[model samples]
Target: MKLIDTKNQLNDKEKHIGKVVGVDNATLTNIQLKAGEEIAEHDSKNEAIIIVRKGKVRFTVEGKPVEVTPEHILHMTPLEKHSLHAIDDTDLVLVQVKP
Candidate 1:
């Protein structure tokens, strides 16, 4: 069994927003976003589920912006463009389903 503590894994230095703690054969990564930071527009080859753990964020998927706050989750299919902004100091987890 593998267990991870999101708070500890996040390094506040390297990533101004948050750190990507990779696990499960790189199938999942957790990102911590500082207030006012953002994950610029981009796309992925694998499907991903974004789970908001702490604070809030604006998640733009396929050009549609959705507000995701703590306890909220959003899914994005492969090749779907998206972006995220930290409405507050946010903790996000990205679970990528590898092909």
Candidate 2:
């Protein structure tokens, strides 16, 4: 009964790459990265699924290196330590579920 056009949410401000696009039962974030950009190490406060919308990214999850490409997805559990880097220009959607 709802529709979200993710493409319109893409935003390229000074030095930004992520934005909260929706929040209800779950939190949805639109994340984009220019080549060589990175999201420093952090912990997920809730369960999250990172959906690759375009390009590629290198994700270090719990110290394990993984490459996620378009159409691929990465899951993170609560308090999971992870980091992400764009090997190329990339766009992603992060949906986090509240516990």
Best by lDDT: 2
Backbone collision count in every prediction?
Answer: 0, 0
Query: Which ranges in model 2 have alpha carbons more than 4 Å from their true place?
Result: 8-15, 18-20
Cα lDDT tens digits for candidate 2, 16-91: 4455665666888888777788999999788999998888999999999999998678988999899999988788
Give the best candidate by TM-score.
2
> lDDT for model 1, on a 0 to 1 scale?
0.76
Task: Please write out the lDDT profile of model 1 over residues 45-77, one tens digit for every residue.
Answer: 988888888889998888899999876789889
Q: Candidates' lDDT values, in order?
A: 0.76, 0.81
What residue runs in model 1 are displaced by over 4 Å at the alpha carbon? 8-26
Q: TM-score of each candidate?
A: 0.80, 0.84
TM-score of 1: 0.80
Worst 10 residues of 1 by lDDT: 8-17
Query: In candidate 1, how many Å is residue 73 off?
Result: 1.1
